[model samples]
Target: MTNASTGQMTPATSGVLLVLAHPALERSRANRALAKAAKGLSGVTFKDLYEIYPDFVIDIESEQAALSAHDVVALQFPLYWYSTPALMKEWLDLVWLHGFAYGEGGEALKGKKLFVACTTGAGAKAYHAHGYNRFSMDEFLRPLEQTAHLCGMVWEAPFVVHGAAVKDDAALKAEAERYRARVASLLPAKTEA
Candidate 1:
């Protein structure tokens, strides 16, 4: 796989870690489908935050271990109030610690890849300068991009399913398939021994 920003080839053994953060995943058609699609792919470790941490008490050591094990970290979530869910924020605050993810001696995430996949209730048109949201998706995702940079992680182009709430069954399925393919493409190609 080639890095999206650098146009450089990635290691053949790089694995992927997909973290899904949806508080009400059962009610979200888009997130559920995407999670199902991603969970079946090879070289991907999928985790459902809400399912594992219903109490919002995250295991910092386990989360850090998962991050260290994978070369690519994909965050899958819905646009909750134009940002990640409260639990995800809490996890980041706790897991991404000063000496682990940043600051002095915090080189664990360096050279890793960060990918963001999100679903928005409003359509693409609604997230423009003159649209209802008055900001583009890129604008809203700046913080994540910056976070990736701060941790020395390469930022990949985000995958978004706009107007997710209104997409019909077929459209939603297609989006999920596309997301699966996109995530798969990020995985390193296996080599025969």
Candidate 2:
């Protein structure tokens, strides 16, 4: 599959890891439910960054090992200041090192797939230029898109749930179900088994 930003591509593979980094998971109803689904599913690893490294001292080797084990890497978070949360950015900075994720001899992530599952407070209508958010989701995701390309990984289209804050519990549950299906469906067949 071709990345949205760079047009670089990689064939899909098995075993997915959903890296969740929500600063306020306590207040996250939809994301928490979606993460619960991933936890229930066998073979899909849900690594909650905030819970794992509250001090921001990420273990690089361990993080690299996790990346190596999974064919599909999902960056799951709420759009904070139109970008990833602080710890998530720290993950990219610390874990995606020059000789590991990119640069010379950086073949670790080649052929792997990276996807973003993001939440926005505003509805879809507000993402347009004429709307309040003033930019498309794709536009907001350029860093991830280019980063995936540099790492020789395929960037899948993001799975986004807009207007998450005021969504009813029933609606959130249904959205969670759809989120589960979407993540499940996106998994490589071998992993799906």
Runs in model 1 lying further than 4 Å from the true structure: 1-13
* Candidate 1 residue pairs in backbone clash: none
RMSD of each: 6.2, 7.7
Residue 108 in candidate 2, Cα distance off native in Å: 0.6
- Residue-level lDDT tens digits of model 1 in 1-193: 5767788876533678999999999899989999899889989998999999999999999999889988899999999889999998898899988898888999889999999999999999999999999999889999899999999999999999999999999999999899999999988777653
* Model 2 Cα lDDT, one tens digit per residue, 1-193: 4456777764433578899999999999988988887657755878999999999999999999889878889999999999999999999999999999989988889998998999999999999899998999999999999999999999998999999998999988988898888788767774211
Q: Name the runs in model 2 displaced over 4 angstroms.
A: 1-13, 191-193
Q: In candidate 1, what residue range of length 10 has the lowest lDDT sum?
A: 5-14
Which candidate ranks first by lDDT, i.e. highest? 1
Candidate 2 residue pairs that clash = none
